[model samples]
Target: MREQFPLQQEVTFELARDVGIRHPQVSGSFQVMSSNFLVNSFDPALPKFVLQAKYAKDLSDPRTVEKLELEQRYWEHKNVPWFLVTEKEISRTASQNIE
Candidate 1:
């Protein structure tokens, strides 16, 4: 098995509502994508958006899900919130911790 995997385009942008911008009601999106790099270079007001996304089909495998989690933690450590957007409405629903 390889430690590094291919990069991807995985991002679905949502309307800010605070300001009208980009496409509205974007679909089949990911905060990030396959085969992408995290580049930090841009205006402060209009900072660059670093995207990171994986495919839903991968979730079927427990190993893939674990790998995704690892990636999520990596982004979080860098102070970036890795958001996921899926067409599956059920997946969109928040999980109940009930704690």
Candidate 2:
């Protein structure tokens, strides 16, 4: 079985609006998906996108590339924007950005 990570914190977000002479109506909400990551609103100033990351040593393998393509198609059908990434890319970027 795969090991699980410990929970460090929790946050909540609500998209709501008030109606005339009534309580606030919630249009939507966001929460941590599968307890692995936090969800946040996309910056309106930037282009809409979703980043899908995976850890794999074989960069030439079709599986890794296919997974990203599948995710891209799924999100596209839902009208959500997406981009593909990998674990190595994330680590490299983090290391470079560290002061």
Best by TM-score: 2
Candidate 1 lDDT tens digits, 1-98: 11233332222122222223232223744334121345454667534334444466766876555445545544554465455533343343342332
Candidate 2 C-alpha error for residue 24, in Å: 42
Error of 2 at 23 (Å): 45
Off by over 4 Å in 1: 1-49, 85-99
RMSD (Cα, Å) of model 1: 16.1
Rate residue 8 of model 1 by lDDT: 29
Clashing pairs in 2: none
